[model samples]
Target: MNERNSASNNGLTSLSLIGDAAEVGISPSVQQARLPFTVRVVADDEALARALAVRQKAYMRHVPDFASTMHIPEKYDREEGGLVLLAEAKLTGSPVGTMRIQTNRFRPLAIEQSIDLPSWLSGRMVGATRLAVEAGGPGRMVKAALFKAFYLYCVNQGIEWMVIAARTPLDRQYAALLFRDVFGVGEFIPLAHAANIPHRIMAFEVGTAERRWREAGHPLHEFMVATHHPDIDLSAAPSLAWPGTSVDLQIPADPADINSGAGNAVRRQPACTL
Candidate 1:
């Protein structure tokens, strides 16, 4: 894959689905939508700590043992080509959700430690991990928003595929988003990345997401494609610097105004509430 230097003049990447909607058979006009919370890339030590707090709390509900180790930032959280996203309540500024995205641009994906990817799965890939969200109705929205943020990040970085290793039941949620199993149909393999817990490896093609979602009459089709979410901000995100280089990720000093409704004419939707 060639290096993708598609950052705008102000140094922030734009979502490809939003930029090339017509090509994917989606409406160019996006409806402006708002959530009770804001999703953004974790840029400072305090932000990361808040993210870890939510992560640990979310995990404590299921995997108490693993949750114990999650209070502190993981090594991958600060690695090159990897970034953590945090969702915070607009009213309280408390973390509600978080996810870590790791790309194969700099090193083998964390998933690669367990199984060798098929040759057909080659090319620019990103793996979503450590996905954790608070419980309840609002948490559901936060989880969905975080997934959208992950998809947007992949599209912005010119990623070919979005990959994840999910355990049972939780994997079903990804299936609803149209991710397909990479290994076998309904096959769960032990993943070292998840503390040897069995998980189904799934992948979604980033380049084809818009087309696929539209074709399937997906429930989130409008939300994912035609909705302008100013709350899901990635302007402070570190640029996908040179490929194959061990350069550290750094947020731009003056990131682009991604929330600016430039080409997108919008209709305001009611703000979401918990």
Candidate 2:
């Protein structure tokens, strides 16, 4: 951890996915030849397809029924205020991980349909959905990198809270990351946007991530904060532009009727809200 912080703070160019390249006996030139992985917003149809493929494959392993619909991208993928993050192996250009992050800019979050968010959770909140990763070679490491990308995006966009509806067992991972239950502990709510699947609603305060981790001596504190991942790119582009305007979404109060658009392009409101 100290080494990562030193390298990052000193602006070293030999950073690796999980450790320094030099420590792994790889020459800088060889290390630079291939990117370990890349994290970026889905910008084109091809990229979206790759993301969908990974999402489907990963979800199928755990939730086959829900995974069926994931073959095609959803409406929220292109929402101006929401974007999909795809991680690909540079060597093959194949997606290894994917996550959909949607901010509550114009409408309430998807989980809101199942349970009302407290006022404290209102405003500048971002929700991560469809988080999936290939189950090989440093899968945990890949997940960490993807999370770092998510954290950076939230910071850049001034997102306050990072929220998710995690399923059983998977919710334990978020708990290890210090995410708190948004409603009740062990209470699983069926999410409308998730094929009526039950998930535990959880949230992490974005702005307090650093402080909380440091104070708690969190296991991921160093990897998340001290380490710098240049591979995770969030540069602005045509498709990557954030939708600054709010879009009117007809949110339903009942989880059964919550039909939050997934792959569809957001119908932009005249004035951007977020």
Candidate 3:
């Protein structure tokens, strides 16, 4: 894998530097928040494989049948308008969480494959899918951090709506974040992309998220807007990076060369056994 040097270097800034804080009107001192794991865009095949491994493991616990098909990368993972985020433990350099964000830039969102989005929702939409985190207390933090990354990515990309298809209890989680249903309230529709499973389609307005959270006294509001997380790096992702700049993606020629350290975007941490 051939590494893109510029992407790796430019990706190190904290989330506080990515967007204008004055727009929200409640900028605190913006304290830096550090975690035991680093979340970043999967820039190479090796990172993608690690993300897939964690994805399959997380799915197997709840959806073993569906997990069977997740061992390999899906077509959506490689699509031009999409980028996969991978969270790796700082200790072992092992993937702890993963999420894929797909924009309706060149094509329709994967969720659209299952149902048509209402005409009322328009302009620069993104769907977050394949969210999975390692099990345990740390996993909870990883899930939240991944979401913060998702939200930050949307902000940087000028995305209007952040959409998702959640099932059962997961739908409740999104609700807690103030995400509203696209259809009728609590309505679950069968999604073709999700193995025909019934899921409630929900959407979040990216621009108004901070204001809504602050107004509703949302618990995660401080963590989402007031704190800065340097570990959640979206600058490596061409589609999500700083506005106006573009970089051509280069995928490794051989999938078997997983051990090749070339083109890796994962930040090196202190070595430790898993």
Candidate 4:
């Protein structure tokens, strides 16, 4: 995680550094200046908690003990030294989606294995977790945007791989990113470290990830993951860098939103492995 933070900070000091695709692309037309929204990394604990609250509420709506907070900052963010990206309504400053990317050391799977992996499998890669978006996600655009920030980091870090432990079971979604399932495995999440509740082991190779995204056909989101999870395959289902990964999402009503007078955005499919 420290590596990620250091690399990102270093990019600021050295402006000549090559970063994300967005930076390379030609500027959008002036009329396009109207903000669709704004994205930023959570530099403070409060913002982190607010982002976690959104996801926690979603998890607990079904499995009561499943989740109640974004506990990474309290327990792991500092020690692990990863990064947290937040997307908010540019107009209201309401955090809408979030994803956490950290140095490979934060993955529970590797830690539980107690077996060290080669630099290619671990050091050359990072781990992405706790990805969540608000109800009306615009086919998950906000989540995709936050992911892009991580990709930019990878480009600067020169990292070559990515690993993820999913709880939501989003295989088809991930597969679209060329994240084929790598065969080997490692996993364990003691209660002492339970944040999103249950965590699973998953991984992906950069080439595979790039291929998946290139193939998934969601160009904007594809581009986002490419920069955020660059080591990830943009065109493959699951991934080859480590193991298969996916996410499960179900719709639930949030009293907070209801009180503000908005209904649940949409009724979603069950938390399937899909």
Clashing pairs in 1: none
Ranking by TM-score: 1, 3, 2, 4
For the record, the alpha-carbon RMSD of candidate 4 to the native fold, in angstroms, is: 17.2
TM-score of each: 0.79, 0.74, 0.77, 0.56
Tens digits of lDDT, candidate 2, 1-274: 2332233222223222333321221221111112378888888898999999999999999988877888776788887678888889888878899888887876777677777887778667889988898885545556766776677666555566898999876787778778999889867988776778899999898766777866875554544554344576666322222355242222222221111111111122234464
Candidate 3 least-lDDT 10 residues = 256-265
RMSD of every candidate to native, in Å, equals 11.8, 10.9, 12.9, 17.2
lDDT of 1 by residue, 1-274 (tens): 1111221122112222122211221223434556678999999999999999999998999889978988888889999988999999999988999999999878999999999999889877899999898886667778877887787666555567888999777888788778999988989999776789899999988777777776876655655656567888987766775454243223321232133222112211122344
Best by TM-score: 1
Candidate 3's C-alpha runs over 4 A off are: 1-30, 240-274
lDDT of 2: 0.65
Tens digits of per-residue lDDT, candidate 3, 138-251, equal 777788778877876665555678999987777887887889999999999998878899999999987778778778865566557665566677667664332333422122
For residue 104, model 3's alpha carbon misses the true position, in angstroms, by 0.3
* Number of the top-ranking candidate, with lDDT as the measure: 1
Angstrom error of the Cα, residue 265, model 2: value is 34
lDDT per residue (tens digit) for residues 1-274 in model 4 = 2222222211111111112222221121111111245666666778778778766655555556646443435444444446666667766777776676766533544333433444446545677766776764241656545555555444333345676555434544454444544434324333223443444445565434444434554334223331222222212111122222232111124312211111211222222243
Poorest 10 consecutive residues by lDDT, candidate 1:
1-10
State the TM-score for model 1.
0.79
